[model samples]
Structure formats: structure tokens, C-alpha cells
Target: MLKQKAGTRSPDLTVVEMRRALAQRIKLLAEKPGEHPTAIPGLSLYHRTTPTPCFRASYEPGLSIFVQGRKRILLGGTEYLCDDSSFLLSSIDVPAQSQILEASEKTPLLSIFLRLDLPTVREVLSRDDIPESPPSTHRQGLVAGETTVGLIGAVMRMLELLDTPEDIPFLGALAHREILYRILRTPQAERLRAIATSGDLGQRTARAISWLRENYAKPLHMEDLASTARMGVSTLHHQFRALTAMSPLQYQKQLRLQTARQRMLMDGLDATTAAYEVGYESVSQFSREYSRFFGLPPIRDVKALKNSNTALVSVA
Candidate 1:
């Protein structure tokens, strides 16, 4: 028999305690006055304040878990939202935008992001020791699922590495692997299952998705690209849209615009030049498209980014 809460269905008490513990650990991490640490070696830690709105962007394949706030992401046209009780995963390189919907200064948003390694994910799927269920639901690139005690325990174990940096190099990898294993066994495992195999239609579409991610500015020969993935043009057109909620061309366009924005913000590329480098033949067309996607013209957006950095420097 299971114990029921005052207003909710019965679940294991151990599961409830584990989920609460994960949230507590995350809260403590957020209180630390520095950049949030990441599981990935290359990427810097990231934490933020204020409610942000979704803007066209590229989100690398990763796990995004929140403890105190809620966020909604727009992947192509499909929307996925998660809060304290839920978390999200993306198994493929994806173009999307995300915004924090709930946050405050006192108890600001606390999030943990883990990089996704396709090779590792594939290895896990191929292992005979672990079992993954057959997928039946329509697949989307992003998925949100209810948090579980096993998953929360894995997350807590991951954070426990912060104090023992020496152990992290070896132990962290194991813990991270455990977290992925937990996800693979979760109810939403179907999404990851789809991305894990090369034989499935969804997996084939992901192959083409990865291509656009690395070569966003390259001129696309749709038929040739489809051939590269061993998919026909018509089949690619249909399944790709079903998985990502956008056509290949539309995905590339968003990728180009987001890249141009990043170049301007980080590399000081001027609007027109950045536009040209992103495969835009007409400066006017580029400007119009950029403005439409970002809600600001290139010059204004870049200027605002500079000003924000300046303010941060002034405070520090």
C-alpha cells in the first residue's frame, strides 16, 4: 500500500523525499555567489536573473533541470514547458528559443544544464545490459516528464561533486551516466529511444538535423542533403517536419539569423557583414528577417548587449 498526501494521489514516500532533496541541493547551489558549474568541460557556468522571453537561438543537445522557476521553450513551432516538478531533454542538435516564465530576486531561478553526447547516448542504447522500451507516441525533439526519486537522487549525486573536485573527473562521469540511464528508463524515455537508433525514421531525420546545425550558413541542396541521410526528398520533408515542427529550410534560416546575432554580440561583426557571411545575398532582406525574428534590428540588439555587459562590469 502507498501513502497519499492530503490532496494528491498516493506515491512512494521515498520518491517524494528524493525529489525534495534535489530541489534543496539546487537551491543551495544557486545561493553560491558565482557562475553555476557545468558538467561539460568546455562550456562555462551560466546563471541568470530576470524573466526572459524566447528569442531565436540554438540550444545544444542537453538536459535542462529547474528547481525554483519555470521555463517554456519553442522548438521550431512546438512548445515545451517545465517547472519545479518537471525537467526537459533534447537528444539532438536543435534550433530553439527559451524564456524563464517564473522568477524572483529572493528565490531566483536555479537551473542545471548537462551537455548531451550523442556517442554516449548511442552506446547506452546499444548495451545489452540495459533495456529500453519500444516507442509508440509521436516523437518531438524536446520532451518534459514528471520528476522521479531515482532521477532526483542522480541529480543530487551529481551536485555532490562540487566539493570534491578531485573526485569529479572520474566519479562525475559515472554519476552523469547514471542520470542518463534514469532518463532512459523514465516514462519519457521514448523520446530518447527515438534519437538513439539510426534505423528509425525519427533517427534518420535527426541525421539531417545535425547537418544543418554545423553548416547553417551553407547553401542547402535539399535533395542532396536527403540523400546523405539515406532518406528520400519526400520522406525527409514529411518526417522532418513531424519531428521538429518545421521544414529543413526554415530550420536553416533560424540558425543563420541566430548565428549572425551571436557574431555581432561576441565578435563585433557589423550588421551587414554578419548578414552576408550567414549566406544572405540581399542586405535588405537580411535586415528584415533578422528584425522579425529577434524583435530588434541588428544594430540595436548588439548595442543593447554591449550596454548590458558594461552594466555588469560596473557592478562587479
Candidate 2:
């Protein structure tokens, strides 16, 4: 967690004011419940008017700042609570179940999501003035921390740029760098640093994860994955689980299940078709696993999702 500097005055009042200001901006930009992509590259706003059921989703490498309300994210067996005062940082792509815990029509859940730029992170790490943190034995890909005033201010400036289209081409890059630099100053910097540093085991593990994400449909061979990460099979398994909270096989199963759900939901594919498309050889096996993961059969789950979306649209 990021701590306030020594001898510095408490920033409670300033944080509250800035949070309210940021929430107003998000309300103006979002205008409805859902993820809203901004003109600025890699920046997105999220607003939710009501609490939601736990839903499966994939999070990429990014910073998620919760400016209002509350959310719950379940990664593996661990649960993370993100409220107005918290931020969730993901250093690698991982699957999780998330739900909105607090939101209402009067005060919706508001947040910001920004994809991390690897090049910029590496550039910041190259600086000599930055202090180094000792290596952690338990490397986790997803972490939660308290939101700092400096981080909130930087995000507010990023949102301000949306009102000036011309400034985005120039000032946008500066804002991105500033946000990263602010994060790097915090203890959470080690997570980003581990992945950005070349020749690091974390970086190698990230390579293997990237491969899994892109080629989930392909048959997964431990040897191939080990070769991709340039580590022995056992070492790769240990490092992979340490970072992702799941083994390679478990991770691939999640990817397949999630993609299959998407195909069925968006493309009107049937269970059998979607199953085969996502590398599941047997439709029955896919149905069994899908039921276990999502708490409903494939057909029923898709129907529920479609109905929920339709209701949301009608309400809007």
C-alpha cells in the first residue's frame, strides 16, 4: 500500500474534494451504466447505477481507480474489496469474478481504468533516482492498495484533457507518464517493475501468459510453455502459479470457458459450436465445466445475460 510521506500533513479534506470533482466528471462523460471508452488512448470510464451479480471477466495489465461506491473481485479463492478509497492494479492478464457491491441511482459507482504502457514503465524504472524495493517471494499479478492524493490529481488532469481535443495529441502523453511516475513512487511499484525489467523471472512468466492468452484454443503442452518462458517445467509451474494464482492448465481452462461464453453470447453460436471453437473436444464436458464455473448451464446462462442486457437497455 502507498503511505503518506513522513511528517506530511494528512490529506483527508483534499482527497474528498478531489474525489467529488472526479466523480462529477465521470458522471458527465459516462451518462449511463457501463464502460465508456474515452478519446485518450487506453483510458476508460465505468459507471454503474445498481449492484450486479458476480460475473466472469478478464483484466489486462492496468490500474483501476474506484472513485465512488464499492466493488468485490474474486481471484481464485481470494477476494478483494475496492471502494472509493481503493485502487486495483493488475500486472498481468488474469481471469476473475467481479460484482458491484454498492451503487444506486442517486450515487452511482464511478471509476477509471487505464491500460499500463510497458515502454513508459520501463523508461521510468531506468531512472537512477528511483529507490529499489527488495524482491518479494510471493509475487502476485493482482493487488489492491489505497488511492493516494497525487494519483487522484493526475487522473483528474487526464480527464480534463477530454474537453480539449487538440491538447490530447501532445499533453496526453505527458499525463500518461505522470500517472505512471506517481504509481512508481508507491510500494506497488515493485509489481510493475518486476514485469517491466528484462531478464527477470516475472517477465518470463508474463511471456508465457501472453502466449496462453493468444493461443488458448491450441493444445497446451507444458514443455512448449516452458520453452516459451525459457524456464524448466517445474520452475515455470511454480512461478506461473505464484504470479497468476492458478496453474497453466487451470488458466487455459478459464480462457476457453470465457471465450466460449462470449462467442455464444455475441455471435449466436450454440453450445456445441462454441465449445469446439474454444478447443473443447466434447460438448458434454464443456457443458459440465461451464455449469460448474458459471453456476448455470450454458443455454440458461446465456439467456440470463441477454435478458439482463435487454432490461438494462430498456431501463436506459
Candidate 3:
């Protein structure tokens, strides 16, 4: 159960009640254990009936609200523990490992994930009425915070819109704006704002990350990447590590490996073929790295994943 503060407030509902309502709605929509995309674009609901093993996945820029159960995310050496009251904000694309820690058939893990619309975030930031918070010294891409009643209410309304199909095209945009506005009002908004603001180092580093993600199969050149972000090589390296919790080369390797795993599982590609397809020149080197990262060789890992009934949940 979600632990409530002594005097948490809401206009017509307590925080815990609001969370329960949201969870019930999500449970109704997501009847099975997997990601369920809704009519609203960029919004997805997740349900897991049992605790899962740690799985490597990539998280894009988004806001994830947990209404039930608990999860843990590992970014580099840092571990973030999230429960019913927690919200995770990802300011950029990142690779990480995640596991569902507290879940059961009676009380399954439930969450609402909304992919951040950069244009809407920028629009919300442009408003003069939004309260200003202190700038964050360390601009990490993924941060977790406690959820508030107001934020939960906005998310609940977003889910409520699914019942009315015609209202989505018009009200959905407004809902998106309001959700972003609520997030910007929080102290955690600084990292998000820095990334959305033009010419900011955070945004520049984000551009470099985007480039790396798009061209993961290609050979990486530090000078070219630095030039793409319009920053000096050393500065780009500093800011890139500051935001992603890993060096650029490490990030690229993760992308390459994850994509290769997906292809081998989903496309039936052999280990040698998958390695070469994902820019690995030597199959032996790819197999060694894959084993080290995934704790199993390519064939064994893919076979295990294929036999398992659980799907990898990527929203963190």
C-alpha cells in the first residue's frame, strides 16, 4: 500500500485515494502483463503481475508515474528505488537496467508513462507565470521524485480522456500541456528545462546523444560528435558523461549490444550475423562483451528470453 503523509491534500480526494483510483483505471485498461498503448499518443500503461529479473533497456525522454508496487533502476553505479509515490523523469535517451521488486497477482505493479513532447515542454517553459527553481548543478538525465496529488490528478484526467474518443484530438493537446506545466512547477524541472532550452550545454549534449543513438551501427569519432554538438572535445566529453552517467563510447556500445540482442531475438539473426550487422567487426569480441553484459552467451540468452513469459518493461 502507498504510504501517505499526515496531511496530504487534494480538492476532492486524498493522495492515496487518488492513486488508488488511477491504479484501478489502469488495471481496467491493462488486463495483461505488458505495455498497453492507449488512444492518446505517447501515453502507455504498464502492468506486471509478478516481480521480474533485472533487464537491460533504454529509456527515452519521458515521465513515469508509479501508482502501485515498487521498482529499482540502475544507472551506472547509482540505484533509484521507486514505489507507488514515486515519479521518474528522464530528460534524454539513456541505457539502464531495471527490475520490478514488489509485485504480486493480488496487487500488481501499475504505472503510467508519458513520452515527453519537447515542443510542449518548451512552450510550458516559455510561460512567465511558472515559478522558478534553483538551477541544478549536476544535470543527470534520469531523476526520481515523490509524486504529489496535483500531479496525480492531472495524470488521472489524461487517462480519463480515453473514454471519450472525439475529445482526444482537441483536449489531448491541452492535457499534454497541463501535464508538462505541472512537472515544470517542481524542483526536478531544472534538468528538464536545461535540456529543452536552446543553446544550453544540456541541450547540446542531448544532441550528441541523439546522434549517437541514431548512428549506433557506425564507427564513432569523438571529433565529429563534438563538432555536431558545437562544443570542444573535452567539454563535450565532460557534459556527455555528466548527463548520461557513462562515457560516449560506453553509451554507443550499450546501444549496439541492445539492438543486436533485439534483432537476434525478434528477427532470428544468428550471432555472427547480428554482430556484423550491429557494427561489430569481430564475432569473438561481440560474444565476449555480450556475455559479460548479459551474463549469458548470445544463443543461451536469446533462448532464455524466448522461453520466458515475461516481457521487458522499458519505461523508467
Candidate 4:
């Protein structure tokens, strides 16, 4: 929840109106109670009828705007809550746990997700007219901010494309760029600027993260990761933790565990085989860590997950 001080101003009424309008539009488009793709590339719409139990997933860089109800996302120990008044943005790919906190049959959770185009972000930064924001290691890659009329308007136009699919090829890209421009003008601009700028801490950390993602099944070396990121080991450790909220090894562990779970659930691999495929040397060690991370051993967890018939609407 947003804090309200004695003299603090209340939210603007225009934002409330925009939120309602977006919610109504989504309700019309998303007749089913789950995530659905729109005509525009990299855009997804979501609707949910009830509060949900927490579920874990990896989210790539994107902006999630909730229109009707509230949702909470947990990244490491950080909590990001989004509702009609606010939006959440992830500037880098990050593993997170999320839950729907407020929704009902009459007023379900409605949301739109716009995947960030890093190339376009870099192109926007390259324009000489745009002001340069100084880079900082303290910048967090995941954040939530109050919605603006301009941002909401851009999203509204993007969603409007669903009504006229013929104009999507020519107009959708322009509308997406406009949305990125609006976000680049916000206070979080520097955080994103750092991610796209070459040689910056954000870029360096991003490279390291990419490497870990691709080679998660292989044994990791701290020095090798630092070298790949073009930073000293100490600097890499500090900046990586500041951006991602975890050490390099911890990040790899999460990737491995998540992948192993996916293999078992999706491919029907046995627990021991899945563990080995994900680089676990010992089955006992794999079971212990898996249990610690997922709250159950592999077999039992997979069974429970398969038995549950609930459908979760999420954005990545």
C-alpha cells in the first residue's frame, strides 16, 4: 500500500478515470479468465476472477499495469504491489513470486503487460535531445510507480489496436515506441538508461546474468563470470547484488532449480534424472535444496501442481 502522510496529496482523479476506462476495455477483450495475446507483438492481457496463492516464475523485462485489482510480486525479499493507481516495471529478467491479492467475480483483476524492447530503449537514449541520467549502482532493476495520464493514454491506444487488427502492422510499433518514450521520461529513467548504456554497471551485470541463464547447467566460476561481465570480482559482486538482490551463485541455483522443476512437470522426467540434467551431482543434495526452495520434495510438489486445476494469469 502507498503511504499517506498528514499533508500528502491524494491521487489525481484523472488517473482513477483512466484506470476504470482501461479496466472496462480489458473486460471486453479478455472474456476468458486467463492470459491472452493481443494483436500487437510482445503485449499480453490478463484477467483473474479470484485471489490466488503465490506462484513462482521468471519475468523478463516488461511493464505490468493493473487496472481493476491489486497484485503483489516478491523479488528476493522485496515486495512490489500494483493496483489501479500504479504499474510495475522490470528492467532486467528476474525470477519472482507473485500472487493476486484483490479480485472477485464481479470485479476481476485486469492487467496489461508490455515487454520492454531494449533496442528501442537504447535508440531512445541515443537521441541527442534526451537528457542523460547519471548511472548509479544503487539503482534497482524492479520497481513500481504511480501511473501517469500520458502512459495510460499510450497503453489505451495500444489496446485499441485489438478493435482494428488491420492497422496493427503499421501502427502498433509506433504506439509501443510512444509508451517506451513516456516511461523513459519518468523518474526511473536513469535505472533503465544504465541497463542499456554500454560499459555501465547495469549493462555489465546484465551480461553476467545472460551468461548465467544460458549456461546454468554448467559449473560456475566467480572469476569467469566477473571476466565475462568486464568487471573485477568485487565490483561484480557488489553491483550484481545491488541490481538483482542475490549473489551470482544464488542466482544460478535458482535457475537450475526452476528448470529442473519445469523438466519434471512438463517433460515428465524423474526427480533424479531432472536433478542430474540441471547439474546436481547428488540426488540427495538436489532433493534437499529443491525442498528448501519450493517447500516440498520434487515428486510431491509435482503431484500437487498437476492435481490443482486452477489457472493463473501472469505476465513475463
Go through the candidates in order and give the clash count of each.
Answer: 0, 0, 0, 0
Model 3, span 118-216: residue lDDT tens: 988888888899887687764678888777777888998888899998999999999999888888877788988999988899999999999998999
List, residue by residue over 49-131, the lDDT tens digit for candidate 4. Answer: 88878987677888888788888887766777777777777888788788888998888988888898888888878889787
Q: Which candidate number would show the highest lDDT if scored against the true structure?
A: 3
TM-score result, candidate 1:
0.86
Better of 1 and 2 by TM-score: 2
**Candidate 1 accuracy as lDDT:** 0.71
- The local distance difference test score of each candidate is 0.71, 0.84, 0.87, 0.82
Which candidate should be chosen as best, given TM-score against the real structure? 3
Task: List where candidate 1 sits over 4 angstroms from the true fold.
Answer: 1-16, 30-35, 39-46, 304-316
Structure candidate 2, residue pairs in collision: none
Report the alpha-carbon TM-score of model 3 versus the true structure: 0.94
lDDT-wise, the better of 2 and 3 is 3
- Give the per-residue lDDT of model 2 (tens digit) for 216-242: 999999999999999999999999998
lDDT measured at residue 162 in model 2 versus the true structure, 0 to 100: 98
- Cα lDDT tens digits for candidate 1, 1-316: 2111112335578866776666667666666533565544522233455666555545566777665566677665566766666667776766666666776766566667787776777878788977757655646677776677777788787788877888878987788788889988876778887877769887888889888878878899998889877889999999888777788998899878878888888888998899999999988999999888877788997797677552111000
Sorting all predicted structures by lDDT, with the top scorer first, yields 3, 2, 4, 1
lDDT of 1 at 232: 93
